[model samples]
Target: MSVFAGHRLTCIRGQRVVFRDLSFEVNAGGLLLLVGANGSGKTSLLRLMAGLLAPAAGVICWDGDDVRRDAETFRGVMRYVGHLDAVKPALTVAEHLRFWAALQIAPGSPAQPEVTTALEAFGIAHLAELPGRFLSAGQRRRLALARLLLVPARLWLLDEPRTALDTAAVARLDAAIADHRRTGGVVVLSSHAGERPPEATVLNLDDFAAAATEAWGWREAW
Candidate 1:
């Protein structure tokens, strides 16, 4: 099944138009990479797919339903991790996972064990009690990613997911994404980093640069 289908999506920021008439389908078990130079609307497109930002035109369908019409339902089936960690500095690693799991409305009875297993899978179980503010940048990134394992979401919209990570952390992220794809989860991510798995389909934003200019009628900024 197609987890996400976007048709002629257009987004405008101020006088500059970003994407124009962009269309793509991400099926279950598929991994898609969005590659572009800085300020090329990669993040805007990701946000549109995540249902965080509405497109100025066209439709984004998630699991056969219009995301704009049924945002709550669409949100229930997807998870989004942006460039920032979104962790509460006062909370511990375990607390952060539990908090996000709750927000995702994951089944409460299994939340604790699920959080524990996710931390262990990322090799951060030993730091579970550490406060979010005290953890290193890499550790915080892992904790943000651990939210995915705690709750099973069919779609993942990630922005620069590999930032602030060591070699081992990058390996762990690759393995996690591989595992997700193996289990029929779909991922759409924007990254300037050259760390994507071999199977991912690359969508270069430069191909749409002219379209953006035509749609927005502005000079190229990037």
Candidate 2:
């Protein structure tokens, strides 16, 4: 089983100390949900796990090996979905998914079938021919979430994954997450929604903010 852990993680963005000495762990088949007010380091924490940012102190490890030693290799096993949608304006829905799917294919990966399956998973198969410019906010978000199904990755780091998703779309997202977990995939996501994947473990960054020192003029941890 794979284990992803942050030991004594202290994150400082700019001059502000977002959080400090935070430690957490996620194993295969588990879900870790990060919840907090703005600037409480939810996105920052996710970025760290995604290997996009390094901690000022402590270490991030995978199965006891330092991720920094080989961040590229570590990222190969992880998928990061940030706040911004990287969809292209000119690409049709099918083309968009195909582009991302092609990027992750190994030497012998069956590429075409994966793209078709991913769109169907998000219920966007009907929109396959529509260009990105024609989709609604909810549809775009659904497309972004569908990207997760395009390739096999053990860790999924999502930032506010429920944003702009309709009720039905959110249900699809939940189902996709459940399927991933069943396959020993670990997930860490930040969300404000009341409904979440069943059995997900919570890590409220709000609890960490309350324990922070106010001397630094951090002005209410965001």
Per-candidate TM vs. native?
A: 0.90, 0.90
Candidate 2: stretches off by over 4 Å: 105-113, 210-222
lDDT of 1 at 58: 94
Minimal lDDT window, size 10, model 1: 104-113
Give per-residue CA lDDT, model 1, range 1-222, as digits (tens). 677788888788787777677888888889889998898889998888887788989998887878889777778788888988887889999988887777776333354448888998788999989888898888999988888888788888889988898889888888888899999999998888776667778888766654543545444554
Q: In candidate 2, what are the lDDT values of residues 102-204, reduced to their tens digit? A: 7774544454547778888999999999989999988888888888888788889999988998788878888899899999999998987665567888898
- Lowest-scoring 10 consecutive residues by lDDT in candidate 2? 210-219
List pairs with backbone clashes in candidate 1. none
Top lDDT: which candidate number? 2
TM-score of 2: 0.90
- Overall lDDT per candidate, in order of appearance: 0.82, 0.83
What are the clashing pairs of model 2? Answer: 38-222, 39-222, 40-222
> Counting only residues 3 or more apart in sequence or on different chains, how many pairs clash (N, Cα, C under 3 Å) in candidate 1?
0
Summed over model 2, clashes come to 3
